[model samples]
Target: MQVLHLSTSDISGGAAIAAYRLHQGLQHLGVTSQMLVGKKSSDDKTVFAPKSNFSKALGILKPTLDCLPLRFYPGCDITRLSLSLEWLPDRLAPKVAQLTPDILNLHWVCGGFLRIETLAKLNQPIVWTLHDMWAFTGGCHYNQDCDRYTSSCGNCPLLQSGNNWDLSHWVWQRKAKAWQNINLTLVTPSHWLAKCANSSSLFQDRRVEVIPNGLDTEQYKPMDKRLARELLNLPQDKQLILFGAIGATSDSRKGFHQLQLALKHLSQSGWQENTDVVVFGSSKPENSIDLGFRTHYLGYFHDDIALALVYSAANVMIVPSTQEAFGQTASESLACGTPVVCFDSTGLKDIVEHERNGYRAKCFSAEDLANGIAWVLQDGERWQHLSRRAREKVEQEFTLELQSYRYSKLYEEILHFGDREGIKSSN
Candidate 1:
């Protein structure tokens, strides 16, 4: 069967990469999967984007125009978190109609790539994957501690608007109206996000399913630590702790500041001198961050091979995220036989089996994080056991082949049900 996936970019962020991997996985299972992205970065023929220069230039300008509505909310703290407005001039409905896929899989289609009204325009059955809380919320990507989304959102905390009829309310109303008639199903990458979506006013009446992200296991498997270190030119003597992502330290949600506090705690507890920190996706700033130990900043690794090398080189991967939809790096580290250390909260709690595969520290506790790190590294025999289980966790539950098969089944079910009942008509 033919499947079409829509995303903002082909392989830019974690969400984009996840979507692209699923497209590849579907192809491996002999399914015709195509990705139509706003900004195409790869040379994959199956992945299509606007070919004309005019449309490509408009693509570059869409994100800026989409945020123009936020200017009305003058009190907003722009750096607090990300916000998306349902404003864009797009002809994507016709584009999708021309492609004529049996099923439409939507990924991170925000960033001005899709207008809010676009969902209702699609003809085929839709499977929308939530990479963040944007799908259910008023405007902000992560509601954080806000529960206003369960009802109609107004006076948004992120927008800093005090009035009940604020920009967020307008956006929420638009979604509530436009999406009421669509043939859509929601898929979340974690149970925590699934719970959040189920509670949201927009999705409360809709069906929401939990499906964890999957990766290529063979490409991320373990390599010799000594060989990995040598390949990356890292020192062999020091035990390594790795942390990375786009804007790894700068992004507030990533919990880099919390990691700094944990590292300082480790230093005072007598483990500073023996350990070094390795970071990817970000380089050392002009004013370097002091994490109580020497830091090695190996910037972005474009391909999977280099990422695998970095994961293999580390003894432990610390994903100290305050909030995460799903921790991709943690699973990738586990696939490489490197234990992960994350808080026992959000989506991360699902990936690490405490003390069996990895350590799940107390939520938002720097001291507990340090304690967990020491626990993982202090016992050499236990480290091997953790490493073995880490690999096994991904193989049994998160392999690419398994993910493709599950998605295939879901697609079949949607098709069968749509025919028996009524499906949304073509635009």
Candidate 2:
């Protein structure tokens, strides 16, 4: 059966990487799988640059055509919409209408290309992976603190305007009406996200599957610690604690500021000298000021080998996020035999087994975070055991090959059901 995978961006984010990995995984299983991306971002060009300018222009135009509705929602990238119907191009419409792939597996369709109505148009069956909470709610990616989705959402809780597009009505009710007719199934990367999806009005009655995101195990497996550290120029003696903050100073959602605060507390308490906080993106936070912890900045390592080295050299991986769909970095670190620590948030809870694989601190508190870090650092024997277990967990549950196998079987089931249902319903 032919399968078409869709996503907003084809970059290296969790969803993009997940889509690409699934593509590779399906290929391994000898399935005919292809990718359909809304916009070709920078990574797309860098990763798959065309030899000619004509091909480059077409890449640019595909996303640009999705922007015609700016007259209504100016500056909004329609190509990035959630199940967007408004931007579905005539070129794609025919292929979608004709090929009618046995299954269309959608990853992250937020931004604009997919409006809610697009799902209703699909005669083929659909399997949508919930990378975040945006698919269930009115239109927010990460609802930090709001349970309004279980019922009807209005009197906006998370939005700064406290209103949804000047509508007095509940937006989710409208979304529910548009989405209820589709022959679609929901898949979540983490069990926590599955629970959240089940509680939502859109998917409460639907069968929610919890499929953990997979990694390229062979590529991410443990590297030689000494050689990795030497290649990365990291200190061998200091306990290398790796942290990934997307925007070290700007993105509050990442909790970079909170991590800085926790590290500050560690320094004042005389623990900074023994640790190193290596960050992946952007410049180091100036707020880490009095924290005498030696910092190592790897800016950003795009290649898997370099990333594997960073993960292998680190003694432990810290993911102190305020909110996350699923900590991809945590799984990657685990695949590299490095334990991870994060807050006991919804997504993190799925991967961490208390003190087994890693530590999950009290919901987003700096002191609690610091204490968790100290515990992992001081308990060398326990950490080593957890490290081995961490690798085993990834090998067993989170590999690209395994992910492809699971999805291939799921697609076959959906296609068979869709064909049988189509025949029966016609009579």
Which has the greatest TM-score?
A: 1
| CA-lDDT, candidates in order | 0.88, 0.72
How does each model score on TM-score? Answer: 0.97, 0.85
Question: What range of 10 consecutive residues in model 1 has the weakest lDDT sum?
Answer: 418-427
Instruction: Summarize candidate 2's per-residue lDDT along 127-214 as a digit string, tens digits.
Output: 8888888778755566668776776665444333355442212446667887776777777888778878878876777766677788
Clashes of 2: 16
Looking at model 1, residue 391 earns an lDDT score of 98
Query: What TM-score should be assigned to candidate 1?
Result: 0.97
lDDT of 1 by residue, 1-427 (tens): 8999999999999999999999999999999999999999999999999999999999888877888888887887665458888578688999998898999999998878999998888989899999999988888888878898899999899888898898889889999999888888887888888888887988876777777899999898999999999989899999999988577555678888889899999988888788998988887789877889888989888898889999999999999998889889999999999999999988887798999999999988999999889999999999999999999999987788888888888888889867322222111
Q: What TM-score does candidate 2 reach?
A: 0.85
Model 1 per-residue lDDT at 169: 90
For model 2, the stretches where C-alpha displacement exceeds 4 angstroms are: 41-92, 98-100, 162-174, 283-292, 419-427
